[model samples]
Target: MSKRKKAPSGNPANRGLSFVDRRIARDFERWLAASDTPLSDPHNAAGAVGHLFDITKRSGLDILEPSDTADIADMLLDIGPNATGMVDLFHDYVHFRLETSRDPRWHQAHDELEDVLDDDTGISAMLEAIITDAETRDPAVIADALAHTKVIDGVTKLLDWISTSRPITDTGALRLSDIEPAAAALGLRAAGARTLPATGDLHGQTAIADGITYVQSMWHLEPLAAWWRALLDTDVLELTASRVRPGRASQRWRTEPTPPLDVASEVVALVVSDTVLGDLPRPLRLGCFTLPGARHTCARGPHPRRRRQARTPHRDRRTIRPPCRTRLADARRSRPGRTDPQPPRHPIRRSRGLARRLCYRPARGPR
Candidate 1:
């Protein structure tokens, strides 16, 4: 007699008792029917279902199967509610799984779905998930994940959206404090040790400084343009196109035009008296003395001529006189008794009370 084959347990083709039984299928169908929106609603649960259907079709599945439900839900969640059919199917599958198995793995699977769907939705949702996950799991692990999120992009998008949708108001301005975390997250630093001012206090000076700081930290050239505009509105700085250094292409930079020598001298005097003294670099001091038509020559040590000039006192006009010219006959007639000694041979003049001869006589012999 031929050995009789034992009746296959459950459906032989399905391989043992499957989770996707008639009951589960019926439950899923009822959920799908009861859904308020159709399975094709663009913004509703239908998108999710459609995505799942596509995944199932691609997987070569003829009918809804037990093992494929969780994975299909995961895939639908990955693409998010944008895929209506996939989301719808996933929602039904989730409800069916919850009723049938009540397994803890269902909770994990659902969380994964939620994460993919809610990412980039908004800061509130992302922040809530981050804070919650941080509290429940290892803080470092959750922090790592949070750091990986496109937080800066989200913030910039939110700010832009708010600015566009809402009317402009004092409160709409982004405050330094409000953006501190985002700036830190983006690894941007303020240029120096100064803290950025609040939005309300951002005037020309502060705005220029902030722009410079941003450029310095991020190396982005865009902010520099804004900085130029801000500087133009303020007298504290001036922008000029100049050959900043020789042999380099000329460009605009903030600088002060040199004042006249007299005015600069006053300023220097005031600064020297009011400010704490420090050794000025030789080049800087030399730069300050660059006056037009004036020459600067280094003296070899101390000069005796300069010292003599400094010591000499200026003479009065009355103390200087030209020699007086007189004829010998006139001198004899004016002072006949006084010039009796050969008529003193030459006319004389008194200068600074000292008698000086006005005319010269040729030397005679060796006398």
Candidate 2:
């Protein structure tokens, strides 16, 4: 008996393609055939989908087949969503898998879809939303979301590391040495620390290179930007920048001597009352009053929001503190029974007495 020829899965030979799908498939096949396709181009999900749609139309290939689509997704994942020419393509392909594939592997694609959709909105806001969602999402759902969005782990982890530090203080002197280990542990791709040319009035400060993944890692962008902004806002950093010549070849970080206790105390008081201080993240604001080993105590005390215990308004010339006991004791010893201290007496000026005598002396003619 002759053996029967086995049919190809999904009946690929019989699959029909639409005009647009065919066009997209033709372009994709052409792109795949090319030896050099720059991968750095930025495109959104819809654009990526449009490309894929054209590919399907041109090739008459059922690219949406679950197994084949899964393989496609894997290839895109390895290339990364930020790869030139790949971001939108990956996004579009994943969306297709989510909509058509029955494979459980693609179910979490919606989470990634949400993120890809959010890419155009701005990385800072996008990352903040993701972090907020992470706080509320089920552990399994978040894990799946993390798995689906390849860069989410690195992005969120970097944000986590940044958020954990006191923003302004820690960021003021941020170095690669401080961030590298954590970045490595979290799988973040941190660039080498370098000195940059002065930006405007600001001097060349310690700076971290923004790798290609910087944009792809949306959640980290805001915190990183905020950190740099905070560092720039530092008075000491600015002072150091003012002192250094921008074109210097030697890479040296300029540091200001720690403020003396009185200066630091005054600064703490000034910071606590400033409207801008209220706007800073609590962690950053909290560290502004740091001293060697002890935190500077604000005379006004903690949070500005809480109603300060209703202090009696001081009347002009009114005494707030009682008279010193030493003065009272001396006054008592002088007077023998006085409870209140008498005002100290002032000796009459000898110059004034001499002038009075000269004015009052009757015609003492011949002396």
**Cα-based lDDT for every prediction:** 0.30, 0.32
Cα lDDT tens digits for candidate 1, 127-210: 345434534765355334433434212322332332322221131212333333323433443332234444423322232343
Candidate 2 residues lying further than 4 Å off, grouped into runs, are 1-84, 116-367
lDDT of 2 by residue, 312-357 (tens): 2332111111111222344333321122322211111111111111
Q: How far does residue 241 in candidate 1 sit from its true spot (Å)?
A: 55
